[model samples]
Target: MGSLQTNELTLSYGKEPIISDLNLSVPEGKITVFIGSNGSGKSTILRSLARLLKPERGSVLLDGHEILKLSTKEVAKKLAILPQSPESPEGLTVYQLVKQGRYPHQSWLKQWSKEDEEAVKHALRATSMTDFHDRPVDALSGGQRQRAWIAMTLAQGTDTILLDEPTTYLDLSHQIDVLDLLFSLNRVEKRTIVMVLHDLNLACRYADHMVAVHDRNIYSQGAPEDIVTKKMVEDVFGLSCDIHMDPIFGTPLCVPHGKGRQLLKEKKFTEKQRKATLVPE
Candidate 1:
């Protein structure tokens, strides 16, 4: 299993740092989800981990070596990243898109091989895109397009996969479907999966390890049952909520507080009315 870790990492855009002095470890063969409110730097940290963004300071380590020092092809073989909203070329077929994942393993003299063919086929089957291999990428629905992208990532045959908001712009059913697929990959293939998720409940449900980012650093990290609390939700997301166990999964479920039809308070009624109502009951 491959390991990914950050050592005193700092990431910035221009002069302003988005994540500073963040040290994190992604457990091998586990699904880790980074969660936070918008602009809290969850995705920024994930991008840095995947070497998509160079850290302004410190280093990202893959298997105990600095990721920047590794050759691009070598890194690609060990790790694959799917960005937040990836766009493919116009009229590109799904098979063409997935075949690109084999680029890292190909050489001038070994452009096409049985191994490459097997990888692409497995990737397509894994993502359930085998039936849509001939379809244009732009012609597919949102969920299907996302699955196609994931197939490309799977074809890379990396032990570690990093995804930034893979479920973005997807409907509820699609989001669940995508998450289930990733979960299957992790369970069946033992891939190290790391992703950023906006939905706290879903994050808790799907993550084997949950990281909460706040104020440019990791606020808390552990199993969701241990890390997610009403206080943590209020402090990190600025939302008041009740935390409860998910009936089906036994995970933390956040029930946010907002203005809605709530039970009326007895104090709002006249004393005589309250007494009359209580007397009959």
Candidate 2:
């Protein structure tokens, strides 16, 4: 398994810093989810870890070595990253896009190898994109296109995969589908999976380690059951809510308090009054 960490890292776009003096360790061979409200630096932290954005003050380490000091190909061999809303050239077929993942492993003398072929095949199967291998990327539905991108990442054959908002723009069922695919990759393939997710309940359900980002720092991190609470929700998202167990998976379920018809409390009423207000049998 691969290890990724940040040490006292500070990151910024220009003059304004988004994250400051941050440290985090990604647990190997487990699914780690970063959750936060918009502009909270969850995606910024992920991009920094993948070396897509340079740190202003500190460094990102992969396998205990500074990632910026390593060769690009070396990093590609150990890690793969999928940025939000990745775009491929129009009319590119799924197979063609997925095969591009092998670029790091290819050489002029070995342009196409047996291992590359096998990896592409396995990735397609793993993502359930085998039947749609020849479909053009733009022609697929939202979920299928997202799966195709994931297949490309899987084809890289790296131990660690990082994704930013992988389920964005998908409906509820498709969001669940993408998350289940990633969960299987972590459980069966032992890939170190990390992602930024907007859905808090789904993050709680799927994350082996849940990190809540607030004010450009990690507010809390642990198993969701241990760290996610009503107070945490209020602190992180500024919402009042009740936390309950999911009926299907028994994970933490958040029921938010908002403007709507409110349920009246029967306990505050006398037995006679409560019965009098009840609908007639």
lDDT of 2 at 154: 96
Q: Which one wins on lDDT? A: 1
> Model 2, 69: alpha-carbon shift in Å?
0.5
TM-score, model 2 to reference: 0.92
- CA-lDDT, candidates in order: 0.93, 0.92
Candidate 1 C-alpha lDDT tens digits along 47-109: 788778999999999999999999999999999999989999999999999999999999988
Looking at model 2, which ten-residue stretch has the lowest summed lDDT? Answer: 258-267
Clashing pairs in 1: none
Clash count in backbone of candidate 2: 0
lDDT of model number 2: 0.92
- The TM-scores, one per candidate, come to 0.92, 0.92
Q: lDDT tens digits, residues 1-281, model 2?
A: 88999999999998988888899999999999999889989999999988889999999999999999999999999999999999999999999999999998987788898999999999999999999999999999999999999999999999999999999999999999999999999999999999999999999999999999988788999999999999999999998999999999889999998432133333455557557777222
